[model samples]
Target: MNNQNVFYDELCLSIYTTNRYFHQLYQIVLGKYELTYLQYMVLLNIKQQGKSTLVVICRNLDLDTNTLTPVVKKLMIKNWIKREKSVTDGRSFELFLTNSAEQKFELIQIEIARIQEKLVGDDQQQFTKILSQTHTLNNRVQELIDELTNKK
Candidate 1:
């Protein structure tokens, strides 16, 4: 194989492997609360946004409504989140963390921090370097996606 193809394959493998590692770590930690990694992602987004519409959440998370709808419903059923009709947009609903979710958020955050600390152990510089490189790589991927999409 050519050098370029080898590099591309290695990059793909690294990304896939790292993603799985993170997912497993999240599952181990979040399973205690009966939350999956995706569920935690939704809750984190809602926590960051305070209150958000399904459309906004979908856009922010790069998820389609169909994929997120069940998760949102599950969160509601689990009493971690509550959904209400939007006053501005009657067609959509807004989501907010419930009091119970708020109470547990800190505990969840602590576990997340522990996971991150393990990954970043004794090497802040290395962690920052990887974080920056990942963001750059992600931007390039998006640009490539846009270019290919426009060609269609």
Candidate 2:
């Protein structure tokens, strides 16, 4: 194969392996809190939004209500989050972090900081650039998927 093709193959494998490794590492870090990686992501989404509804979370997380509802319910049961009736929309509820969540967040953040330090290792600028490039790559890959699906 040509050098370009070889690099493409290597790049694909590296992306897959890196994602798998980080996901497993997150699971290990979250295990003590009885949280899965997706659950942790959901929490981050909620925290970022401050007051979010299921529809908004779905949009931000790129998840459907069917997939996210159960996770929200489980978080409620775990006392990590709570839902209050929306003042504007009586039909829907707004989700918020409970005190328990705030408390545990600091503890969870300590390990997350450690992992970030290990990954960054005095290369904050490089890490930020990689994150930006990865986001662009993801959008380009999504466009490719859309085009291929349309052609089918």
Candidate 3:
């Protein structure tokens, strides 16, 4: 095989392995709070939005309602989050962080930041470049997913 093809193969493996490692690390970190990685992501999405609806969380997380609902329900049951009737739409509910969640979040955020710094070395310029590339990579991946799904 050509050098380019060899490099491509290596790159694909590296990406896959890195994703697996990251997922494992996230799970370990989140286990203390009894959360899965996806659940933590849902919490972050809700926290970032301040108050969000199920539809909005689903869209942000690239998940469907069926997939997201159970995670949301679990968080609610844990008393980490709560759902309130939407002011504009009584039929729909909005999600918010409970005070208990807020207390836990301070430590969670700190630990996550520590892990991020460890995974991503402390090179400012390199981190900036990686962030830029990641945005492009995400867009391309989304485009491919859309193309494939539309064909189905």
Tens digit of per-residue lDDT, candidate 2, span 17-39: 99999999888789999998888
Task: Write one digit per residue (lDDT tens) for candidate 1, span 1-59.
Answer: 89999999999999999999989988987999999988999999999999988888889
| TM agreement with the true structure for every prediction | 0.90, 0.88, 0.85
Question: What does candidate 3's lDDT look like per residue over 36-103, in tens digits?
Answer: 88889888998898999989999988899999999999999999899999999999999999998988
* Global lDDT scores for all candidate models: 0.91, 0.91, 0.89
Among all windows of ten consecutive residues in candidate 1, which has the lowest summed lDDT? 143-152
lDDT of 1: 0.91
Residue 11, model 3, lDDT: 77
TM-score of 3: 0.85
Of 1 and 3, the candidate ranking higher by TM-score: 1
Please tell me which model should have the higher lDDT, number 2 or number 3: 2
Q: Candidate 1 regions off by >4 Å? A: none
Best-first order by TM-score: 1, 2, 3
True-structure RMSD for candidate 1:
1.8
Tell me how candidate 3 scores on lDDT. Answer: 0.89
